[model samples]
Target: MAHDDSVLIESGLQVLKRYASRGETLSYDDLHRELGDPFKGADVAVQVGKLCDDITVQHSKATGLNLMISVLVRDSETGLPGEGFFQLAARLGRLPSTGDADAKRAFVLEQEHRVFMVFRPVKADTSGFAPNH
Candidate 1:
């Protein structure tokens, strides 16, 4: 079965861009409301996880809330550790404040910069819910 919902996919991408641009994070309720769905929590979770696996988005568990999530895009073509350098930093759930030996901060920063390039600037409150790219 082909499990793809263009609406959901675009929404997920926009959500990531929004979070990065605003420097504000999101929880499940935020996504649910944003998605405006008949979508269940598990459905959203599955979609999110699939996006992460597909290198289309990133997801993370928020520090305070187990159900809270942080998401971003992964397949962005911009931002890199120089030419030809690619890291599998897509669909990441969250960035740890510290205590990670994997240098996730640097990776996420790079990914964020790349994602910025993917989506150009728009109006502050405009819903980035379209796949104009």
Candidate 2:
């Protein structure tokens, strides 16, 4: 399988950029809702994670070390990304395979701050998601 949902990837990137512009974080459910709730069944979260991971991979390639996808968390209270985020971060060598909780939280916070800095309206990438650079 190609595993390439380009439409969802494009749409999800827009949603992330929208939230990042406001220096805001969104729940996985929020992303799902914003993406037209295309996913169904128990794997919706997993599917969403895949979408975020895909966007992160492309965004990283385009912008270098920009894991801006940190804006998507399991929920706002926890304010932490799901295991999938950590997994991808590790796989990309951005973080250790099993970093301590504080370390992981710190990484996400830092990335979110960077996302806000780069994607905020004043400094937004007007070229749209993926940047094409």
lDDT of 2 by residue, 24-96 (tens): 7889888889888998898887888778888888777867765757555555567788888898888888888
lDDT of 1 by residue, 77-103 (tens): 432221111222321343333435356
Per-residue error (Å), model 2, residue 11: 0.6
* Cα TM-score per model: 0.42, 0.82
Which candidate should be chosen as best, given TM-score against the real structure? 2
Q: What is the C-alpha lDDT of each candidate?
A: 0.43, 0.77
Leading candidate by lDDT:
2
Write down the TM-score for model 1: 0.42
